[model samples]
Target: MAVRTPVKFYYDILSPYAWFGFEALCRYKKPWDLDLQLKPMNLGIIMKESGNTPPGMNPSKGSMLARDVQRVSEMMDLPYNPLEHFAKTVFIRGSLTTLKTLAACQIMYPDRLEEMTRQSWLGLYSRDIDITDKGNIIQFATAANIPDVDQLLAFSLGNEARQQLITNTNEAVESKCFGAPWFTVTNPKTGRREKFFGSDRIEMLGWVLGKEYVGHHPPQ
Candidate 1:
């Protein structure tokens, strides 16, 4: 019997790069022999714990980062919208709703977790909807054919899932992941480990699955 390796994907809804990677992950299935785990976290808390400031607060690097992310989004054929509102405001309201909804989806329909995540990301980044709006959240959930939108919403606002989300965030931090779109690949057979960050390195995901990479290098 072969042990299947799990690929843990750490993401935050506010991250455009995570959206891109989430989309990419949706396209690959069992041929890769990978178990995908979606771990949502409050990126702000993670940054604070790691002794880093939010990108939008760093004047010198923020603009450069915006351009770099936009370029990558274009390459991936995904939309990149730099929120006009304050980063903290967006993170507090929008990301929390999205993450909690994701947790609910994970609990209710584990098989459809990837699809739900992709749709949620599209609603936020591509459709430019107010993800925090209850109506919009339910709309996204229903569009994905996720049964019981009201039940999921109840779960999202409930104490249990929220606590689980916090625990997941802490686990990511303990694993030394400091940012969004973190990928952890461990071969269960031999226990080989590989970690990559950002959607730019997603091609490496296929490579790690034993897919031939003729000539590919990590994006700088």
Candidate 2:
């Protein structure tokens, strides 16, 4: 049997692009024979280490990026709202909290991680929900069948899961990852590394996974 390559999907919950990219990953899964391993990381740290500022901090560039993303979302039939409030809010805090929740969900019900991840991303970008809010957290968790939101919340408050998230973030940084929606494919047999940034390279991802890329052509 040929060994399957593992694709490490590094993302931050605050990233709308990650949500879009994840949907693409789901669509490309079977054709590529790819196994995705989700790694939730702190975007703030990743940005600092990479010497890259958040999009909101760069007004002109951020606006352009937002418009581009909106176009892509429309083309892909993905829900997206480019909110002005997102520029003013403390997104890092909410992102950290969401990562904690994901960690708890992963531990308690690993099978639900994909659904919970999708819901969490949609809850933030599509529905404009305050992801940091405890009530909103519970709502998303319950909808994703997270089992016990209260327990998950408690776990998020302490060191066990929080530390794990931190560790994961550190590992991502150590591995030279620079941003969310980054994909790292490791050859199961040869230990070779292949990395891609942004959602635009889904076709290349398909090629790496030995799958056919039959989706709509990515808008130039």
Candidate 3:
């Protein structure tokens, strides 16, 4: 059997850029011959730990990121309408729930991870629903086949889940993560690791993989 190349993604739903990057990955993955692993981490926590401000937060950037999000969303063909005064805590809800979904993937349904990743992103960005809202969170979880919605919400709110999120954030920080849409790719055959950041770098990823860049023509 051939071993598939593994790509590790670390992101937060709070980031429209990350959403854009993930959309690129979804588009180019097959041609790249990759096995994508979605690893959810809160960029908010990473920023706090690293003492870095998000680009959207900088008045100097002058709404570049906000506007870029809309441009990239249209280019990628994924629906996106960022919420106003976006609640930061909602990322925590997603992080914890994503962890639970990943766990569920390990035991029985390995495909659950992909399902949850797509559903959660669309729920937050496409559907434009507030994930911090309990009902919406449950709706996302249910769509992902996550068992026990109330329990998942409780865990996400409780100390343990928060700590897990913190730990994941710290780990990403230790990895020198500056923002969302950070990726760590491991060559399964030779145990090599490469890091790539940003949606624009998706073509570079294809270059590294010795594949044609098809990011401009997204899959229908």
Question: TM-scores, in order shown?
Answer: 0.85, 0.89, 0.79
lDDT of 1 at 132: 78
- lDDT by residue (tens digit), candidate 3, 1-220: 5456788788876777887788788776666667887776777667887798877567767457667778888877777877654545343344445554333333334456566667768877777665556576667768888766566655565555556556666768888888888988764445677788787888877666666785567454
> What is the descending lDDT order?
2, 1, 3
The lDDT, on a scale of 0 to 1, for candidate 3 is 0.68
The Cα error of candidate 1 at residue 151, in Å, is 1.1
Which stretch of 10 consecutive residues in model 1 shows the poorest summed lDDT? 211-220
**Candidate 2 C-alpha error for residue 70, in Å:** 0.7
Best model per lDDT: 2
Sort order, TM-score high to low? 2, 1, 3
Once superposed on the true structure, which residue ranges of model 2 sit more than 4 Å away at CA? 1-4, 90-93, 188-190, 216-220
Give Cα-based local distance difference scores for all models. 0.73, 0.77, 0.68
Question: For each predicted model, how many residue pairs clash, with residues at least 3 apart or on different chains?
Answer: 0, 1, 0
In model 3, what are the clashing residue pairs, if there are any?
A: none
